[model samples]
Target: MSADSMRVRRSFSRVWPVALLAGPGLAWAQVSPPAGEAAAPAAESSASAGSADEPVASSPSAPYLRTQIGMVLETRPTYLGSPNRETKLRPVLGLQYGRFRLSSSRASLVESSGGGGQLSGASVDLSPRGPWSLNAALRIDHGRGAGDDPLLAGLPEVRQTVRGRVSARYAITPSWSAGASLSTDLLGRKGGTLGALDVGWSTMLTPAWRWTLGGGLGLADATYMRSYHGISPEVAAATSRTAYVPGAGMHGVGVSTGLTWNVSPAWRLGATGAFGRLTGPAVDSPLTQARNNWSVSVGAVWVKDWRD
Candidate 1:
């Protein structure tokens, strides 16, 4: 192998065993470097007017690390539409080389929502990624567990499974874009699918600071709705709520915002917030303890470009 290839392999070897966004078992939000944080703008080029808020590019074989290693504060429902809320603190980490990225944050391709979520996964572009891009990812969903709450303790378990996603994004302008994503259970776990459409806008407040806003509409299938929302007669008897059968439709809508700062050449800082609400059958389901959801994350990254 060439020296560059050897160096790339060695870099990955060092980080492979140290789980972060790309790590194993721990399904924090998937990411290499926080996907929520757009990289600082590079020199104005021929594509500059069309590709707003895109990350800096490295050679396909070059090794690089883009990570936000700090605590993330997120407040979300204990379960999908559960009324119960839990605030969690997790560390953020991301590793990238070429067009590939590995992250623990589920906040994947759909930018208009809070996060696309699941676990660390590898992503590759299907077409040349630029103002228009098509990408695919394979990740593991740790699945929902039996909860301590009496309301959720009796529901059918959401089993761990492998998931696949295909997403496409089109830049409408330098500061605005639109995208769609679909996720499905590859393991045939009866885990249905989730799909979303979103529009995003970003602007550079200063040479070192940027801000973004986005909105999304979500949809799910009957199996998905039934798995999470439909309560069985036995579960109804145990939870003291009427059993429900849900037909899939509009899942909900969401809005999100983020800020990223180029603190230095080697460091970047970012913060993001999102809000969502359950709609259609989800709101009427007994298992949905809460109809609204929200979360926030903040962190900083130390970057190293092997080619640099």
Candidate 2:
């Protein structure tokens, strides 16, 4: 009721509303966790989500571009002639863009006949997307022998090859698919054409591994010469032989199998084996006949991108 008491009461009344309005906010501020703890779980959850998304990182694109460049050391033991031996150091380059692939390879026979290396080849492959994927490839190769080299001097030759393949796949399960392919090859010669056909089955052993097994028949005409050698002009002129010594128009059967392993998302390793037997008119020719022999090759392949 006194002046001092009334003045104190008036001041308290003015501050009460503001204090009441700030109470809940202040309580919340005090109860909140420290900055580090409050942000810890959020950061952890975000990292987990990122980890979950990684498996799908490679699936976004179609018609990916994959490329491989590597060297292959080959050993050939003389089957028909003298004990011919050669070591080759080769440089190989390959490019794949979308559904198309191109490659070229050159090798120098380190100790062999010609001053110029023996063999070189170039190939192009096309694989387009469709209900059934179709793959086609063409290759050309040449081999030359030095004048002094006894075994290959008469064998200097150029060869062209064409191959076509059609394949279709059906998914049997989430992790398994069954597919079949039909393939054929045509060899061009100065005299005639040689043709071969193949049918094969491919199975996916895992997401990163595959295997193929196949067999086929081959037929060649009189002028059909193998790509590895050229008939000597002197012999051809004297013998008036349009066909190879073994003659032409021969038939043979062959079997082939291959395995591919994906070492990483960007690299692969492959091994292939082939065997053949020759029959028919040309079989009599020492050079034209196919012998029961097996060839095996292993290679490493690399790819740049999997996106279109």
Candidate 3:
């Protein structure tokens, strides 16, 4: 063969291998597998990608298990009318687990005329499902000086009071709710039992602010006339002969209003005022009529949320 012919044969041989090598990729680009087979790998890849994103969904569950704790301080310079005047400093602590919350408050009141001391209480609030919620609390209040009567002399005293309240609220609008509460108080010597029924309207004025107004009527029956002014032995002796006095059974109406502002995600401030008037056989008595009173208080509250 001539040299040119030999070179042409070598070039042809090189071109044939290159063509063979490119055939598979070109065919792959132009042709597709059967619909079922082709779709499967794509579906699998998509699923694997989705699985990688699955962990992001678990983020929401973190709030449920997270614990929220807070401390609060409150001061009430004077409540009602007591000669000594009053100041109360209360420290509050709370823990929330899911929809259940457990809390306690310790109150110390100082009276210039009479020495001041402490009162403490614990409460549990639970909301299992829906808009319904329940709350129960037990409180013990201890202080010396005048009891409930402004006219009476101070008495050395120890008293235990337990209170339970249950309420049902239904949302009337995005910003308003209507609710009612049944509350009972059991007082232990110088002790009495009081039952109250209250209906209220609550409104959310802003995202972090709310207001409530409520009114109720209640009955209080006492075993003895426990006066803030200690009953002199003479007065007790005079009343002792009478087994039960019709004047001791009293019924009254009460009204309350409160405002709460959420200062931040975890801090809140609230002010509340309440007034009551007695209207019954007991009200005619000088002592009972004088005891009709009103009280005002301002407090700071803190709340935290936990979810699971």
The best candidate by lDDT is 1
Candidate 2 structure lDDT: 0.35
Query: What TM-score, to 2 decimals, does candidate 2 have?
Result: 0.52
Candidate that would win on TM-score? 1
Q: What is the C-alpha lDDT of each candidate?
A: 0.55, 0.35, 0.34
What TM-score goes with each of the models?
A: 0.77, 0.52, 0.52
Backbone clashes in model 3, listed as residue pairs: 63-307, 64-307, 64-308, 147-228, 152-229, 153-229, 153-230
lDDT tens readout by residue for model 1, 1-308: 66875777687767764533343343343211122321111000001111222321112344443343344655555655666666666665545554555654533221211112212455554545456666676666666666634566767787776667776667777667776667787888867777766777777799888777776667778877777678878878887779898997877766667776778867767777666667777788877776776655666655554544
**Arrange candidates by lDDT, highest first: which order?**
1, 2, 3
Looking at model 2, residue 13 earns an lDDT score of: 51
**Candidate 3 wrong stretches, greater than 4 Å:** 1-87, 104-120, 125-132, 141-150, 154-158, 161-190, 224-235, 238-250, 285-292, 302-308
Where does candidate 1 have its weakest 10-residue lDDT segment? 40-49
* Tens-digit lDDT string for candidate 3 (1-308): 56655665465446544433322221110000111101101101111111111111111122121122333233221211222233344444433222222333321111001111101133333334454434443443232233433433333342433444443444444333443333333454353443443444556688877665555555444432333222445555665522224434435555555565768866666555555555454454333324344444555644443221
Off by over 4 Å in 2: 1-64, 76-92, 104-136, 143-192, 226-248, 288-290, 306-308
Q: How many backbone clashes are present in model 3?
A: 7
After superposition of all CA atoms, the RMSD between model 3 and the true structure is 29.9
Worst 10 contiguous positions by lDDT, candidate 3: 28-37
